[model samples]
Target: MRHPLAHALRWSAVGVLTAGLMCTGLTASAVAAPGSPPDPALSTPGLPPPAPASPPAPASTTADGLALTPPMGFNNWNSTHCRAEFNETMVEGIADLLVAKGLKDAGYRYVNLDDCWALPERDADGRLVPDPVRFPHGIKAVADYVHGKGLKLGIYTSAGTKTCDTAGFPGALGHESSDARQFADWGVDYLKYDNCNNQGQDARQRYTAMRDALRATGRPIVYSICEWGQNRPWEWAPALGQLWRTTGDIGDSWGSMLSILKKNLPLAAYAGPGHWNDPDMLEVGNGGMTDTEYRTHFSMWSMMAAPLLVGSDLRKGSQATFDILGNREVIAVDQDPLGRQGTVVSSSGGRWVVVKPMKDGSRVVALFNETGGAQRIATDASALGLPGTAGYTLRDLWQHRGYNTAGTVAATVPAHGTVLLRVTADRRWAAHPPAVEPGLDGDPLAVAGRTVPLTSTAADLGRTTARQVSVSLSGPEGWTVRAASPRTARALRTGRTLRTSWELSAPPGTPTGSYGLTLRVDYRAPSGVRADSTLPVTATVVVPPPPGESFLSDLPWVSAANGFGPAERDRSNGESAAGDGHPLTVGGTVYAKGLGVHAESELAYYTGGACDRVTADVGVDDEKGGHGTVAFEILADGRRAAGTGVLTNTMPAAPLSADVSGAHVVRLVVTDGGDGIDSDHADWADARLRCRSAS
Candidate 1:
């Protein structure tokens, strides 16, 4: 994983702190307001250009036959990085749980150790030494313990003079051969070689040195290049390592995951057997996001054929965590023998359809929803490169169900969720019941005590007709749901639809959060065979903006990210600790209410389409004493509504205003002013939003 010092040094050298921040965590994909217009670059026709006929097999440069499929394993960095708990006991416990919890059986094998496993300095013999307190029995004993459990062991080191952590542990920069021999002697099976304090060495030469050294050991250690995509490792690293990181470290948030997905999705051509495009490790079970988001994270990783490195503390994992991790069906996609990475079939309006051609001639279709609300994402078998067969069999990998589609494949995917389906041509598909895909149409954002009208539709995509079709929508406890129209139909012919309307009302005192709603569909065939399906729906309760002007700091933000520390309210960006900032000040003036943030920061608030205008005075905080430069921009639903040219700490505050009428979410963004992020403390003084009364 990347460290702050590495990021600061890398960006300061390039004088593009903003770009570095974008890769680290504050990516454009993460800050783009939800429900925004689709990126024009990703907008394609319903049927995208077909994938190459007979895609070439990945050329293996190492010739070791290692990592034939993306490595499935556990990495300790994300869960307990450099913590006292990340010791021999924890590593052994993870190995035990991997087997006891069925993860090893489900395809996870490696139990890896990240940084901090070693002492800060090497021994008198110039060999790296394991921390005595951390691994009292030594690395070999832990490696043996892991191997005894039928799993592999991975260790981390940097290609620089020191590892990424502040501990400055000795790295393998000039010691590649010695370290490689040492690791091989210990029975280490995998090596994560990172980029940090490299002294500006050539990435290729440095990595190749290790690759040659590892090969010299006559060991089959899987090499993972963690250069953070600084040198486009995908273009050359395949010949040197089994996998290369394609992005910066991944945070446990929807924005971070989505941003990395956008970065990695374009490099599908460079990934295959024995070599992979690593998009960092998995953040599942980390708890920064909901279970739905985690499912999407896992589903996308599997779809992309990316390395599946579990980055959670499995000892404290819950049932939901195990359920997501132990999904053998999803893991199969990642381990698909074909070794083809999934590519986008079509994308528009925050909905994406990605298809991966399997060796069995089937296609894995992932209908992904990146919007702020549930959406009906769809694609047809033809679009997925399937022949014009009479029928197609669809297996919902997540739901573990079988379905038959005449041609169209679709599902109502929740916000930040994915519906993974494996579709294959099946001539006997007609023998199965009709594949009725269910969808919900309505605003997912609801006001407390308001009756929101919603419609659910079931479309038959199977070859045969369905009889006695019925649909029901149920809300969470304390909420009322009533059918507004007929919920049953006598028949639903192929390609026809049955629609049911319902009025949903949440109690006045309902809290603000996502609530679950279930849409169940029951249908029978002409021969009296019956089938039922239940689809989950999500409704978010939001508080409308107050009438009249109100300071932005008073409202709870939907999400926030900062370059150096957490965004502060009505204060100056001091240090990393919360509430440690001074009063908001810029150009020697103090403000009573404002936001203090570092460069490359973003704060979003749910406007609920009620706010019409936002006004603020933006500047680099005077606390830096003319040391920082930055720019500010405001976005309404991902569209830039207002912005300020570069501003330095020496300049007075600049008034900024934006027309945010009809915007559901308004975002405030700050970026480094070209030079770097040194002392880049920014402020939004007296920021206020004006809204109409909630009707």
Candidate 2:
């Protein structure tokens, strides 16, 4: 699917290193309009906007309104499986516990079923029939059982052709409208739409298709888009979903838990009241995590405003799990009606501090030490800006206690633990204080050989999007112009020299190379305001080697792989040609990740000499639920020599196969399609298809 957004950056050229000032503007959308009043409707006490509008009804009951504070719920996938004591009996038992134990009274309403609920095939009429063997009473009966208990019931499905379980149920695409109707008929309230087999389509189409499908049901199921983090969903998924997955599946291990939390901190702004950045599900009540890690997990997730989807055996939950889940003070932060995701204010090694600006004009601060040792936490009076002659109210969220504090508060946080302090006004304030000007430091930007620095200032501006600044420049003789980081068409040309112009957008992955263009300041303020200022710029370009030398020849691997080294025969050319060098020739296996391929093909090497010894170790995880395949092939002396296989257990796992000559190649082909051979266990380790000179 072609994204509506084609331009990521643009650049122009001016003469030499330094260029004069030009007009620049920051549009209204780029910057928040000055002094806009806060929207009261946006901060609900706990409920957030529904995922997005779908048939039946949009996931949200309110229209773009802020969410009610926190959401509490239990999901089954974390502990339940197709095998091992999971049946209608288990479901009923868990459901009974949810009500009898006061979890529902504690604000957890949804009893969400994860995967493996469907039968191996749809009914003859194309309607998905529940696996009668698993749930003898059917899904509707289960829904009623939960609904009678005053709790909502949630179900799951995939956007692809098959469920992640590789079971033969239909998907949302082509079947979206139908499946949605089915879910609605089943009285489903929350739809956890997953991405299993839908690899060929772009995120926009895949997500939007299901969004529309769910809406078509007229059932008002919450739309949850599960695409991992490809295409930066947080930037656009809100249009299609209420919540979007932000990372790979999280396990119930301390390392897995911490890694996921740290990865999401930089994306704090993407989360808000109605829309949330989901970090998979909560694993706190699950057994793999320690009590300390579980507490930290709940604390961090709540601070992050992440949807609290508890993934554990609630019936068997320990007292610690209940305490962690039932902490109303901590839940207040997670359910903070303001919906503001906490942001990192300070960090050092294993200890860090974060602050969430509350709608009540106060701040919620968390001092976290995720290590095995205790750390002292101190809040500077200057940083908090507490006025003299007035005391502030400090509420300990975890301890559920309130007190008065003046200047600063000090506490020692235990290892792998947190101290959450909700600082609010002791008495109702007349009005919020003026916005403070944030501090910023400027640096010299080089263009060509000139420098421009010591000039920019950063201040507080309420805007959803960041601002971009550019410079225009002219060049000297013989320097026609090479390229720009932000490719732009507007260039200032004069005589034999060309002026260079620049524009900054979101950064890309390629190393930010220094372009040889004169630089100037084109200020685009967050508020549609435009200005021009003089700034310095410099240039850094890597000069190519002499005529006789080739870039690839510089690597020692070139000699090690032999002149008979690896090289590609053909490429699928199925997607964009962004950073990849076409006609890939590998003296060795140039293995890079994130290929974004939609079809099956090969990455092969060709050497004139008859060669073999082709081996590969395949690591596969079923994130979307359906099976993924990887194949190894060996080509020697212009003929196929050997091949091997790796497949999924649920589906037939296909082995690696190839047919080429010694002079042809050795390769790896990964795809969504195959002959369906070894589909049961989709994993292979160092599986090699070796064909050497059979001298």
Candidate 3:
């Protein structure tokens, strides 16, 4: 069977680019400059003439051929990102953590080092050498150390005359053969060859040069081609490298990850046991995205059969990161011997359904919620390419739960969350009761006027097929439920199932809160038994909080919470972040902590400051978090007024006032001090604004 990503949205259809690819905003650092001043990343001091290239070695026969499966391990690029921490010590720390954290037993074997590992110049023998300050023990020592711990080692280099980083590290331009031998001599098991300042060389020829070089070394190293998909490597990447990057570098943000995922979702055919599509590294513990978003990141990468190279400070990782990285069921999907990459099968209302076939003939189905709000995403077995309407037994991979599906399956996916399950055909026979799971594919969280999708997966277990099955959602007064179910029941095939939907809308008058919701599935089984009277499962309907007060206050305050950088309000550090969405709150207080563990919060929008002057008491939200120091500020137009220099722990509210005369908006900015943003939930307590005069 053709893989979905490879055969769909092929390069021929997208009009492959020459050398430049539109990266949108997420690819700020993905491109390489033309022959300009030697990028610091590309320059290396001169050295003695190099020795002759070595002869090609005989082919080897390793048990699991190189990259027969997506490589599981950690890389230093994203997590450290030129932080000066990409060193031997860092690699040693991670190598230790991988063993201590049981990652080794979980199949995470490689410990890769990215760029900036070399000295400013090559050795007298014309060979690359480790920076003495960062790797005093030498490259071979680190490789030996990693190997001593039962893990493989990977390294990075560029195909051009220079590297991509600002430091301009040396490249393999004229020394591919020698460099390959050098890596093999040092026990390098993998190589990430990048595209940077290649002197305008043809990518295919340049990559091929290195590929043949590595092959000649006789080392079973995994060759990773990082060309940012500019030349559409998928068209010819299988022979170039074990894996090839399909897009530019991935930033540690929701938007960046989503953009990369969307770009790679359609190219599954080019991936298999010995070759894969690389989408950069994992950002699970990078503190750039939320825990929920990280889950989506891991799920999508696994489903795509991409390398699971984590790029975080594993030594300092949190439990959430550990769970995501150590998820065995998810890992199994990525390491499936069949090596088939999953592809998007269906999409509706911003929800996507991805399915990958397993070695045992089972299918891994993922319901991804792409919108900022929660959603109901559902898919039928037929849509997943099932031969018949067999009722499938579904196993929630993350939650570790097992249940029988109603022939079709649905899940309520949270914003940036996924419902991943392993589905196997269920042919067991049953008689008597019909069943339905309500609200099966939507989040309990919703906004007024926005459709809160709900699903009912109905089942007919008896020998006789039900003539008709009715499914509907029980609505609140004045709330309308529109359901679409099958008028006539399908035949009672053993594994076949039925699914129906109900989209409910919260009335404009509905207040912000949670309400009860129930769904019913009534059907007559093939044995003439009625299940319409059975009780249905119930879920909650959460209406979102809108603007408190009209045209003046029509828009909810927009917020920018987290990214490793400073919040826009951080005048002291010249740091800024941005997001154009309503703030999230709990218990009537805006939980203004931004993304990641150390986040920033800037809540601002058009506000006449009610009467042209806004006053409020600001402090840390005592109810949500009790730790961390947060600086609070009030700004009107461009003028800064009252502010709380810094508040730590459960503290008293400090008065804040902003003059809004002739101003159109006021902003509340909170910055977590150098201590980081863990538990830095700031509150704009008792805020009040004066309206503009109608005079």
Cα TM-score per model: 0.84, 0.53, 0.63
How do the residues 363-469 of candidate 1 rate in per-residue lDDT, one tens digit apiece?
99999987655678888988999999878888889889786788899988876789999998967676677789888885466778998788889888887888899
Ranking by lDDT: 1, 3, 2
Give, for candidate 3, the lowest lDDT window spanning 10 residues. Answer: 1-10
Give the TM-score (vs. native) of candidate 1.
0.84
Clashes of 1: 0
Candidate 2: where are CA atoms >4 Å away? Answer: 1-70, 166-169, 381-389, 427-695
Decide which is better by lDDT, 2 or 3. Answer: 3
Clashes of each: 0, 95, 35
Off by over 4 Å in 3: 1-64, 426-695
Per-residue error at 685 for model 2, in Å? 21
